[model samples]
Target: MPAIISHDTGTDAAESLVYTSQPPVYTYTTSLISYALPPSQFVTPETPQVAVGAFIFTPPGTSPPKVLLLRRAATDSYPNLWEVPGGGADPEDTTLLDAVAREALEESGLVAATIVEFLGTVEFGTSRGNWCIKYNFLVDVEEGEVTTNPAEHSDGRWFDLEEVRTLAVTTELMRESLVKAFERVEELRRSRGISDPVS
Candidate 1:
């Protein structure tokens, strides 16, 4: 049986991984879909990875700002722990922001209205032997229902400012990320008039 891998969001997206004992074969599909990298590029286990976080914010209206947090399945990293919707930057994504948006929609069915700002970057080494630079982004999502991608998250919900402040997690890092995400959203909302009702 051959293993397969795919990259769907970059300047060079290599979709499908064909693993065999052979020396590897390259095939050009379409004008927009050929990637030069081989299967080796997909085997990045210990490599320091770059990740993008989607801090998808909802308007305050008359209440405090809220952001979506997804708790990954126990089989996944940070199992059963809540974090912003996002994932690592793939070889296909043109930018970190695009990864955030792509991962967010994949994890939770929500589209960002716009990427408001880049909060900052945080470096962390996981227990699973992977180190990553997590790039956090603040995004304004169009008002609508949020649907969770069951494969990724066991639970997903929007946590308001106060709930965010007290959300439980084992690490200070995640706590800080959520707190910071809320702060940034507040600043973005007020400065950009995001919650202002149109007359």
Candidate 2:
């Protein structure tokens, strides 16, 4: 499952809608406390799925090597917890990359230039329920600084990889995914004889 923050800016009707992603097989219902979802849904091996996430990396600038993180505002589920930029894949999205682009634009106001590689998936644990997968990808930020959606996230910051390693990440699965991807990025750079972008 993926959650996003949205607001009505009026320029576009979608700006007013905050979108979330669950397996397409599931339907959402209304509730006074929060949106209601089925207790459990099943997905077949052929079920339609979407990939929606970007592991953003910035070469060391004024700061040491940095990656972006969003602090989720206290709410249902992972309230007050921090996460990388991601959401559900949109129905209209023709490809996983398309879903990734839309989520990045809505949540972080960042545009993607290219997808460097497919890092893989992160499972949040059975406690989070089934019927969903968090697809992670390495995206090259083509341009622009990050401006966050106030509704979904309280703040956004750039943190050194080492720094994030020191923090208490609530989800161990995601932490392992990030660490592996980060190492792969470094390995690629080394294979090409490219120096650390952040250095």
Candidate 3:
């Protein structure tokens, strides 16, 4: 298991808590990543219907890094729209991070290797008239092919930052999240003295 590291913004408020893990040396395991606690807001939801979204990037050496996105099946809620791999957290999930890894695997057949950063969260009303809060994270997955589930998603593709602007992403919040993810990716690369193709 990778060491879990977290930082709080010196506040007892729920939204101030942020959890992350130290960068891991890629290894294959059933428990791919570990997390401490999700923000109180997500865990204490009145309905306990929290969801998780993952923003996975291509391996470090891939020039012009891209993010994986899956197109929803026509029968789904956001029919035919492109979005990151994610869904509602299940009771069987040990932690919110587990939900992240599970959703990625079930929806896109990708194994999460590390929980890089907490992107943020979004809350919206569901079709059933209940609010759903989704915690988004930046994740690094093991090297492998992507096989999206035909029932939940119709197609899956890696889109560079430029190409993301051209796709019909699920929602405005999701579009903003993608932009923030790209910015975060560039920051991470620069911090490690890696050259960014767009820079």
What TM-score goes with each of the models? Answer: 0.68, 0.67, 0.78
Separate clash counts for every candidate: 5, 1, 0
Top candidate by lDDT: 3
Report the poorest 10 consecutive residues by lDDT, candidate 1.
Answer: 2-11
True-vs-predicted CA distance for residue 123, candidate 2, Å: 2.8
Q: Identify the leading candidate in terms of TM-score.
A: 3
Clashing pairs in 2: 60-198
Per-residue lDDT for 87 in model 2?
76
Distance from true location, Cα of 173 in model 2, Å: 1.0
Task: List per-prediction Cα lDDT, in the order shown.
Answer: 0.58, 0.55, 0.72
The residue-by-residue lDDT of candidate 1 on 37-125, one tens digit each, is 33133235654687777776555553555667887787876677788887777776644445655676677776544444566777778
lDDT of 1: 0.58
Candidate 2 residues 1-199, lDDT tens each? 2322111112333222222443122111111012121211212343334345677777423234456788776663576676788876655663455566567767787765444456776544333344456667666554576888777887778766676776555477766766776676665555555545422
